[model samples]
Target: MNPTHDWSTTPVTTNLVRGAADLEQTPHGVLPHRLPAWARAQNTDGQLAMVESQPSGVRLAFRTGATTVELDVLPTKRDYVGAPPRPDGVYELLVDGRPARRATATGGNTLTIDMLAGTAETTPGPADTLRFEGLPDRVKDIEIWLPHNETTELGALRTDAPVEPVPGPGRKVWLHHGSSISHGSDAAGPTTTWPALAASRGGVDLVNLGLGGSALLDPFTARTMRDTPADLISVKLGINIVNSDLMRLRAFTPAVHGFLDTIREGHPTAPLLVVSSILCPIHEDTPGPCAPDFSEVSSGRILFRAMGDPAERAAGKLTLNVIREELARIVIQRAARDPHLFYLDGRELYGEADFAKLPLPDQLHPDAAAHHRIGERFAELAFGPGGPLAP
Candidate 1:
């Protein structure tokens, strides 16, 4: 918008994107996807499609000497049908790998989701520009982390100076998959997501496939992870499975095996860590087809409750506790043949004491503070000197 500075338009290309699995060429610009086209095409679930396109750990990385940078983006923000208006998605600018400034775009599309009705509607709107100014006028590696939860369509990237794609950091590439909590949930910003934070502390590049309500051990997802190149891989299981009541214990055990087997096909020597869900009291022991507590709707706060009967575990219904036990057993059984495979109890990241201190705001997802806690814990447990992912 400043006429004094000569602005140069740069194309948003895959080389400039750090964390997305695919780049979708849209009319406006390139849209980053956490899942590749082939994998995305295999699933018809609206939630999966929407979340994979949210770009939780995705960022635009380039080297530039510009004091001012502007990006045009059309962000699709989510709106619960009856709850309070969700906050606008945040775009964080990082200079030389450190947080510099943050801004939020206005007047983009809105996706209204009615969980009760199991329906969603999108209302189109106009694109908005995010401008970052007053940077140090020397060449530096710059990264603009996209909103972790919003589905964003990127447009022209303008800078006062010419920009070129930055090379990778020469660190290990960590590919991770999980539920919405891993997808970012209520994290403060894109880079602050637990996985992102862990990757940062772990000194690794991240490819986050944390689909909201969609980490259902789908074969396509397994194949995606199998084919993607990564030095370290982790999958956080249980929460989404229990909440959706997608499968019983009988189905889940084999599904976990098949999923890991598929990944092993491509990454036989990569360090693979299987993580269970963090402590969620509601579904800790109770089997779920979790339902929203409409009683709190009038109070402008939405909470969830497990609806499945506790007695149903005897009938092979899956619960978080059951899933954790099964995952531990499976890892032990498989570790005999696969020495690189490891199991991490999700509770190690956020367990009973931590829950008492920093509880899950939604009874399912960790809040921003909890995200930081989980990230720090993960970095220590998995990336520490003697840890499983240590070099």
Candidate 2:
């Protein structure tokens, strides 16, 4: 036993005291400690919104029941129309790894906790935190069906002693921003978000501001980024801008500059990475609204100004290819003065090679496996030692 370590069974408000205390926490307790699953634009201001759980892997609050355990779930924010066919309410439940009573919730503004003496029913209006009272205390792990995202702290229950903090190196926030890909699109669980997976793999905390369908280099977004706290940061840009078809080369260049300038305002010296868009065959040089064609499964093409179509081929619109080229140039230009700045093509995370093999089930969002692959690659590339994660 190392002397510096606290090996005592006695009470300590701080972390455990063990020998040779060279290690504080293992990389287990990744940061952005709590997870905030979704953000929504109610009217204009994007506010944090919560929703019902998915069909599986819900992050739930657990307590021992004499014969049953209680469960609580939060809904997804910005529940887009493209979401999986699962209903927007509680549909099922399980206890002590055994099937229990099931229930459902009617559509309402608020979601909540419920009581299931023996059966689980999906009713409505219990709102935030399910208390599973009167269950046999033999249940060890309680699992629920939901996409558990946006958690900060995890606490232990039914004990006199305080719940120990999850072990990990102290919080090292990984600030990331991107499109639907980053928003856990079609991903299995909350922890499957690329940012979340990478954070866990790299042993860092995370601050994920990945918005679905909202990465269009908007002035407001840049301003929001500028104001946010980012110790280690990366921005995945381009695809959305291309698909949005909102600007021309004249405006695009200035827009990119403005966005970077804004982010720099807050994190002047942090390790900042600028990413170009990933390969989307249709959207590479094509422009967008990238809407659903509803005509064909593979009709996910970029919408752009066309010679024949009065809407397209307008001013100086640049495609993802154009942006990727310019982003390199911009980094090359500004990074001369800002040595900390770096660039990574989005394809580095998910390139044409991967795309060909794992075409997205939806034209926009990658499937579960793709999300994990991207996360693993990111963890290795950005957070690995001597990598971009180094302070």
Candidate 3:
């Protein structure tokens, strides 16, 4: 928008992207995908489709001397039917690996999702530009972390000076998969997601596969992990399986084994960590099939509650406690043959004490502060000098 500045346009290509498995070219621009196309094609679940494209850990990395940078994006924002309109997703700019500035695109597409009716509708809109000015005039490593919760299509990227792709930092790559919490639910920004924060503290690169509501022990997801190259791997399981009531304990153990089996095929020697769900009081002892507590919908707030009876655990129904026990047992058994495999009680990351102080605001996902706590704990437990993932 400033005629005085000499702007140069740069194509948004794969070399400039990090933390995404694929870049899809769209009529408007390129869309980042957490899951590759083949894996996405294997499932048609609308929730999976939506979250995988949210770009939780995805970012555009480059080096430039530009004092001004601008990006055009067509962001598809999600709106719940009766709940309040979600705030605009944020774009965070980092200079030399530090938080620098933030911006948000206005007037883009909207995807209205009716949770009660189990339907979603998309409304098209024009692209919006996000501009950041007054950056340091000297050349620096710049990273534009995409919104963690919005489906964004990249358009033109403009800078006052020429830009080139930045090389990877050559840090250990940590590949992680889990549920909505891991997908950055309720986290303030992409770079602040627990995984991202942990990676930063641990001095590692991150490839986060945290699909909201879709971290069921799916074979395709396991296969995707098996094929991807990583120096470290982790799978956080249980919350989504229990909340969706997708399976009973009779099937969960074997599914988990098979999932690990697949991942070991490719990353046989990587430090593999199997983590159970963090403590959710509602599901800690009770079986789920969690349902939204719509009683407060009139106030534009929604909470979730477990729908299954406590007595049903007798029938091998799964709960957070039960899953934790199983995961620990499985990891111990597997560790005998695979010393690189390890298990972390998710509670170690976010447990009862932490919950007492910073409760999950929605009774499901951690807030930004809790995310910071969890990330710090994870870095200490998993990446510290004596930790399993220690280099």
2 or 3: which has the higher lDDT?
3
What candidate 3 gets wrong by more than 4 Å, as runs, is 1-6
Model 2's lDDT to the true fold?
0.54
**Model 3, range 66-124, lDDT digits (tens) per residue?**
99999999999988988988888989999999999999989888999898998999999
Q: Residue-wise lDDT of candidate 2 within 1-391, one digit each (tens)?
A: 2223233222222232110101112122211211122212322422222211111122332322234333233333222232223334332334543435443333323222121121222323223443434333452433333333322111112221112432432467667777767766667655666776887788765655565556667665566566655678888988767666667778878888898898899889989988787777666656664554433423443222311222354555666777898899999999999988999888888888899898866566687899898989888888887777754
For each candidate, the alpha-carbon lDDT, in order, equals 0.92, 0.54, 0.92
Error of 2 at 205 (Å): 0.4
Model 1 lDDT per residue over 1-391, tens place: 3455578999898888888889899878888998889888888898899999998999999998899999999999899888999889999999999999999999988898998899999999999999999898889999999999998999999999889888765788999999999999999899999999999999999999999998899999999999998999999999999999999888999999999999999999999999999999999999989988877878788998999999999999989999999999999999999999999999999999999999877788899999999999999999999888874
> Model 2 segments beyond 4 Å from truth?
1-84, 87-169, 296-314
User: Residue 224 of model 1: what lDDT?
Assistant: 93
